[model samples]
Every structure is written in structure tokens, then in C-alpha cells.
Target: MPLHPRPRALPTAFVAVLALLLAAGNGTWATTGAGAQDRAGSAPRPAALAGRVIVTVAGQQDAGRAAARAEVRARRVYRFALNGFAATLTEKQAARLANDPEVVGIFPDRTVSVAAQTLPKGVDRVDADRHPGAAIDGVDRGVDADIAILDTGIAPAHADLNVVGGKACVTGDATTRDIHTHGTHVAGSAAARDNGIGVVGVAPGARLYAVKVLSDSGGGTISDVVCGLDWVTANAATIDVANLSLAGGGPDGACGQPTTDPFHQAVCNTVAAGVPVVVAAGNTPGAGRDIASSNIVPATYAEAITVSAFTDFNGRPGGGGAAICAASGAVDDVFAPYSNFGADVDIAAPGTCTYSTLPNGGYGYKSGTSMAAGYVSGAVALYRAQNPGASPDAVRAWLLGTAQPQRSGFGFTGDKDAFAEPVLSLGDGSFPSPTPTTTATATASASATSTATAIRTATTNTATATRTPTATRTPTATARRTATKTPTRTPTRTPTRTPTRSLTATPTRTPTANTTATATATATATAFVSTPPPTATVVTATATATATATTGTTAAPYRVAASGRSANSNSSLYLYDRKPATVWISNPATTPPTVAFAYLDLGSAKPIGAVRWLVGADGTADSFRVQVSNDRATWINLTANPLANGPTGTWHELRITTTARYVRFYVTNPNADPRIGGFAEVEIWP
Candidate 1:
């Protein structure tokens, strides 16, 4: 007899009556006859089909009833990330449950396996070796952040690891101990203690939580993976970062939606709860050639930081080094041949011949995107330790913004897709200062006492000739005049001159001046001039002019608040970050040929006259539309007709006239081989 025998068939009339009753109880069926017709249209299968299925409940209140209606006992119930249960159900039962109003989705359980294919030098290559206490000196200085390794169980007794705690989700595994070596290798690559004897991880001594989702053989089901995420989400406050050195089957476009893709939903909830997830771009088996990273789960989700593998033979930037234990044709300092690529890949890291810890307190080398992701998790731990409450998006921004571009000396020879993603670098001096501080001095020589007022006026006029700087000064002059009688008297004598100077400045400064600087200068000047003496008035005026000059020094010609004011679907944050190497790729699975979009929020409604964007290597958009909106509900087309296709890796601009806070890009047809969409950077002009 089968483990799960098919249930006996029921009479059509009886099944129909049962369905109507269940629908009414769930408040999905109205007393009207039309409701009954709708229920009958979605009838269950005639015969039972045996299999395990995951049923995602629309709400916690519906779980019990939904399972009862299906007459199946749940094997596992998820709470934190997903409100659902895993159960064995016949095809007929699954179809009935899927029709339930409270059921979000029902997915067949699929096998998930470890993405093992690592390193001592991956740390040095990514520059993690430069961090304090990250060296292999046999001493544990201790790491401040906690990382969850969602793979096979970790080696609890390994001296080189600091496995603080863990939860086992796999069956027959009551303890969070590694019987297989994959999870142990991953843990060591991410946070192996900095001990002199063996090997040091990317972030030495980081607290490791072994959330074993895969069995000892390094294989499990989607339900098991979701269980691990549920555990992580429950303990999100304690886990700063999580790494999944594992992969399931093909991509799910509906991963962002609540109804489809349980793993994707779990990752989204985990990240939303403050724990950043880093996942592997699964290695392509057999062929040993690259494929789109979007072809894999978790990596296909935009919420997680998806990483691909690269080879760095000498553990340093710049090419010319020979490949060590890499696949044939794998070049040094380039993307690995067996690694996944394409637009979904956020970044790359040293993956070939990585040295790290294994099970039984052993040490060895492995190579694949799994190792690459582990290195990134370690980097994230290091970053989070310094930035205690940084959001997942902020961490992603930092990682991308600081990554080293793979161009010129950086090596892009083996990059199949040519997305040119930046490689991860954690050295202290690798990235630009987060809050770049620039000091600019503008000296305005007002003849201490100009005997001839006309000469002083003429000097101010000459300064105004430098349009950009003078534009910002006009407001400073008016602010000073309005705040004090002394400056007012001086300006009144040369009213025409003051007006001329202000007019000259308005054109250049009004559109691009930093509002914060102007406001700060105005407030400071007002406070100082409140009780001004003749000498104090002159000093304050000079200082105000200098402040005005400094205000424009850092302001870009046409600036948009691209920092934290944009949202996208099926895309990454790299689109507006102004980094050419960091490109945003649309999930081909999620993006339909007719419509795919990404938008920028200008913070508030403003005059937008033109848009400039750079395309990625995938291909150009065959037909694209630009729309603007104030509330993001009602949209007005900026382009009267769709823009024609253009070349890739080059800037394209669209001229338009509109006022809106939100500027949206709609790709009607992405003219690429895979029907994907992408953008390297976008700039809005006023």
C-alpha cells in the first residue's frame, strides 16, 4: 500500500454541496445564487493525487478551518514569516483547499540542496583580511554581530567557530550539529574564529546561529527552508545578518507577492524585520557554463542580496594571476565559468579555491557562489557591528556603493553577461567616506572700506559674473538686508545694483542650491544681525557671502534626492545610485513583455523638464514610456509617443515638461534575448 492512498471518490452533487457550505462558512459565498455558480466553476479534481503541499493561509484565523475542510493534518505550521502549514494532501484535496477563500497559495514541495562547490584567500580577495582581528593568528578578539547560517547544521564543537545557538528544522535532526560538511564549511567562511591553527573567516569570531534547514545529505524541501526562515524571523532582533548557501529550483516571478513563493515571502519578511539576507547564485551543474542568476530561488528575489562567484587566484585586485583550482578557461580576477551571472546578480566575490573550516575541526578549500555569499555575509557582519541599526536597504546601498568595479584593471574578461558588477571589498580604505565632508572656501574681498560705493558695486557685479557662485550670494545679500537696517541702508543706496546681482544669481542657484545650506546660513545670519554694531554688520555680511559661496560648492548642477526616495518592482536599488557598474536588472520571470516598471520619488512635486538614463548590457528597451505623478495614483505621460530603442551602455535622454514627485519608467518591450529590462543609472533634470 502507498504511504498516502487516494481517498474514495465522492458524488458530484455531494461535493458541490460541501463546497458551498465551506465557502459560506468562510464568508466567501453570498446567499445569492450567483455565488453558488462561482463555487461550482472551481471544482476539485475527480480523483486524488498523492503529494506533499505547502498551503499558505491568508490569515492565522483561517489556518484551522482551511486544513479541516481539506481533511488533512498539517505536519508543520509557520508563524513569523509565513502564516501557513506543510501537509500531505491528495490532488483532489489540494484543489479543494486552493479554492478556499482564505488560502493564499498551495505549492508542491520541491527539493532544496546545498550550493557547495570555498576559501582561505576569499577573505583577502574581498579585503576582509584587512579588518582588525580578522587575521588567522589563533586568537579570538570576538565579533559584535550575530549571523545565521541557514544550511546543513554547523560543527558545534569546532574550536575555530563560535556557534552560540541554533534550531534544527530537518527531520531526524534533533541537534544543531553538522553530520555533513557543507554547513560547517559555510560557517567557517563567514565567521570562523580568528585562531592561529586553522583558517580565519571573513568576519572572525562572529556569533553563529546554526539554523539547519537542509538534512545531513545536504538536501531538503521548500517547507524545510521556510521553517528555517520562520525561525530567523522570530529571532530577527538578535540576528543582524543571515546567509543561505543553498538553492532550490527555477525562479518565481510572483516571489514579491504574498500569495506565491513561500521562500521569497519568508526572505522578504526576514529582511523587513531587520535581518539582511545574502544568498548564493547557484552553480550551474554539468555544463560548467554561466546562466542567468535570475534562474534560481532567493537569488531571484529583489529583497535579498544575490551574489555570484569570481576567481581571484592571488587574493588581490587586478588580473594576470593564474587560476588555481578553478574550472577550465576560468581567468584570474574574473567571473567564474561555473558561476551564475546576469542582471539579478548584485555583486561578485572570490569563490574559487577558498580555504576555510570543515566538519570535525578540519580545514579545506571549495569553490562556488555558496562560498562567495558566505564571504559577503561576513562583510555584512563587520558593517552591522559598526552601524548597529542600519536598515537592510542601507546595508545594500553601502555594499554596492563601496564595491570595486570590474573594469580596466579590475578584470572583466570572463564576464559572460558583461554586467560588470563590482566585486566586494571590505578593506577600511576601499570605499568612499559615507558622509563625504568637503571644505570649500570662497573669499570675497570687499575693500575693507571702499571709498567709492560705485567701485564696491562694480566689484560685486564682477563677482556676479561667475554665475554659479554669485547666484547663491544674492539670497544671502537679501537675507542680510531684511534682517538688519545697516545692510538695508547700504543696499537701498544701490537698490538697482542689489536687484541686478540677485537677478543674475537667481537663474543659476534657484534650481540647484542646497536648501539645507541656504536655510542654515539664513538662520545663522539672522541670529548674529539681531544685535549688530557697525563693525559686526560688515563682518556678518562678509561671512554671509562666504557661506553662500560654500553652499553652491557641493551642490550638483541638477540634483534629485536619489538617496532614499525611490521604490521599484522586479528591480534592484542600483538604478538610481549613479554607479555604472552596479546595474538594476528586471526579473524576466516577474516582468511581462507588455509592462515592467521602476520609479523615482523626487521627495515632492517639482518641475521636471528632461530625463537621462544609462542602459545595462542586456539590451535596450524597444519601446518605453515616461510618466509623472504627484500622488502616484494618477499619471500624466511626459512622452507623447514611446521612445525608440537605443544602444546599450550609453546614456539616453528624453525631453519633457511636467511637475511631479514620482517619475516612472515603463518598459513596454525589452528587446533582449531573455526579454529582460535594466538601467545602469537615471538622472532627472529640472
Candidate 2:
């Protein structure tokens, strides 16, 4: 079976754990892979199809020993020599080929993704200074980009939250505020506006749409996480990205993770839709490898942009590396005392003294992988803000391509996490154009096949709303990538590797409160499909990056109020909670991604049983919807050619389910010639 979308890429944050947990710093992030696949709909390219045929001295370090020693000596395209294997491939690439028994598995040349983290300084209440770097730099401007935080809910009115729209999957509260401020904290870090008095955010100008999956008390079910993603899919209009600051389960090493988990699939779906998601590494070191097991859920979801936490020092005296800190045992992922370490980790960030948003009129400090995720989310916004023409995958590639290489332990081995600090750098939005060696190496070995991963076809209604992903691969210390020598392969145990490192510098001040000024929306008319697309052309321009947000809340003036009613099909703005309507003005380019939200009246609001539609008025069979009442039992809902009905109406196709929780099956199947469609939330009360 092809790997489903559910499998999450290792959290970039895990890399931080490696940076923190281990001594000998100087490790960097790795290069990101391509292809935006949805766990539920798309599948990892067939190992047979996506893989290539390449002979190598994999999993046999002994032949390996001669070959390994020889390869290293020749340096003719060589990498680190792990214990059991010595093939050439990235951690992700190596994991992709782990099943080939006869050939042996490859390993990443120090590939990284995520890291362990520290509690942030918490959202502080300070005033912003506009002079020079006094303002938020490298932050995502306030362009209405949907950001999802899979942690505790946000305090809807936190001065620092700058939250314009949100939905709680665990609490089922789409209206008012949430009790917990986890989401607010994460959201604030990724995109709090830089109003003069408040702390600036990474992407201050971006319009943040919060999707609350976890509960007020903190943790939540896998089902709620999945629903939260689904809700984001339905309302892409207001969201361009998502932040997942939580995880479940412990390490399941080696095979990476399975692609069949529902929560994994839901997150993959968002990525496939061209939206980027950021997830956290687990706070606890995984089950096995000291700090190996990664938190499940979004962290393991293949498409999420995972992050790791980093501190200011390099766990050693007078020995701080660039981005590596001293006394790291206390803070930071690179030297983070408690971060989970392994191939799944992607990148590291300043997690301590971090400031964003919090629950009440109150804000306090707490450390964990969550704070690290926020830092990455902020950087992702800047990447998008700088390159609107970049595809989600391409954007991912750019982030990875620019990461400074990080090393592990005493050896400079493996690839870096997919992303690292100084987060965004511009890149031509393009896929890896056929690398003969690298491409072919990924091909499946002609070995006996076993279960790739299970895909349960549960009753659409019977499946859990969100299912935590599981990894069948038994946790293996071998997968952790510590710089160990062959023969004994004992993990390099050095005095510097002590877990009890101290914090050299004190934590930074708390973050400032939110105070986004209200500004009018400005729409621009540019072509998105044009070759070398316009330079970050603004559809709703005012919402630029995090810094500008505090200056003013300028975005498309549109919203769906509490009492608004919709019949069969109606595309609404995912971020718009107001009563106005704003049609995006970007010219057609590659399939234009969009999202919107609406209320399902069922029978209460007299929406008299209607089906919903979003594709071109008459373009059915191209883009379609799969309907589900309970959100679990899903069936296809096709759009009949207008054939003379309301511009966009429901009920013309499939029917007889429930009246509430209706959502259209929206997609941009094609990539060329930008496709246009609107998302509509409707109810069919027959």
C-alpha cells in the first residue's frame, strides 16, 4: 500500500533536542523534500514508483567497514558512517527506504527536523519601539494567513493574541473566547502585531485565524486535532498556514512514521491544499533512545513544518557555537536538556524567554516544544510574505535549502534539520529537477514486501473524529544518529553530554500585550499565474507581516456573523467573521488556494436542505466535494453542472445525511492556470 498522507514528517523541533541533548554542537538543519501529499487522498509515491534502484553498502557498517572506511577516505561523495548502515541518503530519504531488507537501509548525513524546547518568557506586556531593530524583524506581516495552533485554546481578547478568527474543536466553541491560552501564546509568537506598546511578532502583519484543537486544561484527543484541521481546510480563505504546538505518543523509531493516522492525514490535507503547518517536538525524551521518541500527531505528520527549541549557549564553558548555546542542558534544543533527539527533528529556535500570548488577562512562563513551534511559524510567515508565488512545497524547499548545516555529537555527520534560523531566504519555486543519484536512490528495493502501513476503511461516521497516528517501527537507538563509532557503536559518552547543564543567561523579558490598530483593506489586481509571478502582490495588501499588524489591522473587510444563514452551497471567507463580502482580486495564476467558513442552519435557519458547491460555476468532475454529516462518515458530493440553478447551490447531487456540520469538498486538482473557487459552509435541512 502507498503511504497515506497521515504520516507526519518528523517535527523540525526534534532536531533541537539533538542540538541540546548532545554536547559537541555545530549541527545545522537539513534540506527539505518535495511533493505536497494529503494523507487521506494522496499517497507517498509508490516506493516502487517514487523509489529508484541504487546499489550501496547500506546497513552493514562492517563491509561495510572496508567500504565505509574507503568511502570516507575517497570522500567521493561520502557521509557519516552509522553503526549498522553506511549508505548515502538523507534521514528522510533513508527512512523512506528502510523496508528494503536485501539491499539494506540508508541514513541521513545528519538530517534534522525538530528539537526539544523551553518555556518562553511568555507573552510580555511591553511597548514596541520603531527605531531600527527595535521593531519586530523577520516577522510575518499581517496578511490574513490562516494559522492553526494545536494546543490549549487562546484567550480571544489577549492584547497580544491579535486573534481575528478561531474555532475550538475540543471545546466546540466557535464563538467567544477559550479558557486556555496555549493557542494564543503560539499564535502570538508566530504573528502578534507590533503595535507600539506590545511585543512584536514574527509575522506581525499577518491576519491570524486560530483553530483550537487542544482544550483549556492543555492536552486534547487526536480526533479534535483532526477536526481542527478539517475546519481549516473548509476555511482556507482566511488561513495560509497552521501552527501545531502539541503532540501525542512517544518515539516509534526507524521506519519514521506511518502515513495512515487520521490526524496525520488531516494535517497532510492542509499541506496538500498549499497551506504550511508547523508542529512541536515532544517535551519528554522519547521512550527508547534517551531522547529519541517524537511526540505523535502533527509532529509525525509528514507534511507539517516541525520545529525544535534552542537556547543561547552551547552546554560548555567558553564553547558556544553559532546558534548553539552554553549550559544548553537547561534551555534550547541544540543543547536543550530535555528535547527528544532523532532523524525526525528539523530545526532549532530560541525557545527560552520566548514571548507570545497567554490564557487570561494573565500571562506566565512555561517551557516546552510548543514555544519552539511558534518561532518556526513566524519564520514560515516571512517566507510566504517574501514570496507569495512560492508553492507550499517550494516554500518548504527554500526554508530547507537555506538552513546552515548543524552537526551532531563529536562527528559532523548527517544532514541538517529541513529548516533553521535566519529562517527565510528567497528561492526560485521549483522542485528538485531529477537528480540521477538522489532520485534513483529513493526507489524501492526489489525485496519481499510487507505492510507499508494499514489503511482502515472505517464507516465515515464510525472513524474517530481525530485519530492519533501510530508508528509500527520499533524505537531503535540506531535511528537517533548520535556520533557513535562502528564495532561497538557505543553512543559517544563524554563529560560534556551531561544532562544537568546550567543556564548561563537569564531569561528575556515577557512579551508585550496586543494592540493592533484597525486599518482599511486594500485589494490589488495582479496576475498570480504569470511567469515569475508578481513580487508578493497583495490581494488584500494591508495585512502584510507581523510587525505591521500592530501598526494597524488592515485586511479584506469581510466576515460571517453568528446569525448568517446559507442554503445548499455558499462559499464564505474562512477568516472573515464580519458581515461584509470581499472577493479576492489576484489575477488567475497557478491554482489559487482559498478558504472560507459558514454556519449550518440545518433546519433551524430555514436553509431547507441544500447541498454545497465551490468549483467553477459549471466545472464539475474537475473539483469535487466529499460530504459528511458527523464529519466522520464521508461520502462524495458532486456538483452538477449549473444546468440553470442558483450560481452555487446544494442538493443537486448527493443527499440525505445530516443537516449540520456540512462542508464542501474543495480542491485545486490542477497546478497550471490558477483555478478559482470559493469554500461554502451550508446545511441541508430537508
State which candidate has the highest lDDT.
1
Q: How far does residue 51 in candidate 1 sit from its true spot (Å)?
A: 0.5
The lDDT values for all models are: 0.57, 0.35
Model 2, 521-566: lDDT tens digits are 1111001111011111111112122112231112111111111112
Candidate 1 similarity to native, TM-score: 0.61
How many residue pairs clash in each candidate at the backbone level? Answer: 13, 153
Number of the predicted model whose TM-score against the real structure is largest: 1
lDDT of 1: 0.57
RMSD of 2: 25.7
lDDT of candidate 1 over 1-686, digit per residue (tens): 00121222221000000000000011111111221122556533222223776777775555766788888788778888788888888767765765567666666666777776123667777767665535445566766777888888889889888988888888667878888787888788888777666877877788788888888887787788788888888887677787776554444544346554676777778877777788877677433333332345656566677788888778766777775674566677767777766666677887778787888778877777888888888888876766665577657766765566666354345776645667777655322212224332221211111111111134443111111110000110010001111100111111111111111111122222222122112111101101111110111122222233222223221333222322222333456544555555444454455445666655457654446676664454666655565555554444324554344555554433345676666666544434544676776654
Report the poorest 10 consecutive residues by lDDT, candidate 1.
13-22
Q: What are the RMSD figures for all models against the true structure?
A: 18.6, 25.7
Model 2, residue 121: distance off in Å is 8.6
What local lDDT score does residue 374 receive in model 2, on the 0 to 100 scale? 69
